[model samples]
Target: MTSTALTDDMALRIGLAARALPDTSPARLLAVLADCIGLPPNAEKLDTLSIKQLRSGASGELADCDHSVLKTALAYLNGTASTESMPPPVPQSPLINASGSDPEGTIRVAIASNNGDLLDGHFGSCERFLVYQVSADQFRLIDCREIDDRQAEDDKNSYRAGLIADCQLLYVVSIGGPAAAKVVKRDIHPIKIPDGGAAPALIGELQQIIGAKTPPWLAKIMGQPAESRVRFKARALEE
Candidate 1:
């Protein structure tokens, strides 16, 4: 692998490891991490900041982990970071209510989840998928599929992708490069939502867009009706 790739991988590893430790503060984690990697110069008082705060600080403070490491590390910390250390999926919201119907012309989106609620799981690690049908003004919970744990890695990813094959988009906290490729090959767009967002929060944002304008990409695929666009513009001008 290239030097940059190596650093990125290391940063992810460091972030996950740091979050797993108990009673560990971000500042202390950085201090220990620095010492292990010969701790860069010009780094002072970093051990006092939270992982979230540290990412916003200077590159000089990060020493070697600056270039590609800081952002990825912080993403892991913010989205997947926890002292629970690979704990089972805990729902951050209420149980989803799916009607088992997919509305035509709506984008079919899938989210990796441990619970029946949030997009707080990795594509490879999450055992379940929450499927949503998203139109411009509304989104509906349509289906839920759970993977069989007995499958091997090769069997698992592709199989999981197949379960939600009809979906146009997939969301997850993280996904391995290979698994992401597999998802894409099935014609599904994979979206990485940082900070492990709640499913309802994300759905609400999409609904707001439907009420406003259709994004270029979605417009291209779903193709808004000409009359509706004209009507929407007329209303906009009137307002």
Candidate 2:
């Protein structure tokens, strides 16, 4: 092997050996090995000794040197080596509401509305729903879109079955009875909002309700007692 490769290999070997022994100094071990094999300027110089000299064993002091120094240095080196090379363990973040009686799983909430501005009003004439995952202090919006006639039907049935399969909570905000009826069979709790109110205002109002008397599904998803008031300023919808 080239000198660089040999040095790397030696370092890796020393590191591994130190880890295995847990009480050895890898430097000392390398120093002892270098001394016994007629390599370098002894234990003191082992740290800076080149791998080329170590592999060649061409140093002149190997014949007259005492073996006891090599042995003792090797032992001491093995013991101390581990401290320098070991990686620190990664720390984990604590889960929110870990002690709650709810099922050990994630909570999802779906908000269906007639407001087109929620999705930048892309589907101008269509209604939309925003699905979100509730956390201890915040809610993460996951999916938002307008569901067409066919898609609405499919989603109503499919969402119910899927949620039932996964045992997830389903919350639907609908404009009227027809759309609400589509998912009513799923036993989903429907929250009604005025078509005239802005999305942020509606959300703020709903948050207030949840904070005062949280619904069973919301309670599990939120995973924390709500303290702050939900507030927002109104914004005019674009034509």
TM-score of model 2 (CA atoms): 0.32
Q: Which pairs of residues clash in candidate 1, taking residues 3 or more apart in a chain or in different chains?
A: 27-47, 136-210
TM-score of each: 0.52, 0.32
Instruction: Write one digit per residue (lDDT tens) for candidate 1, span 33-144.
Output: 4543334312233333354444334443443332223444444444433433332333232233476454445777788876547776667656578887777666667677
Which 10 successive residues of model 2 have the least lDDT summed? 230-239
Scored by lDDT, the top model is 1
Q: Give a tens-digit lDDT track for model 2, residues 40-146.
A: 22335445444333333434322222232223223333343322322212222323465643333344545443333231111112234555544334444555543
The CA-based lDDT of model 1 is what? 0.59
* Residue 189's lDDT in candidate 1: 80
- RMSD score of candidate 1 (Å): 10.0
Off by over 4 Å in 2: 1-107, 113-125, 150-178, 211-239
True-vs-predicted CA distance for residue 112, candidate 1, Å: 0.9
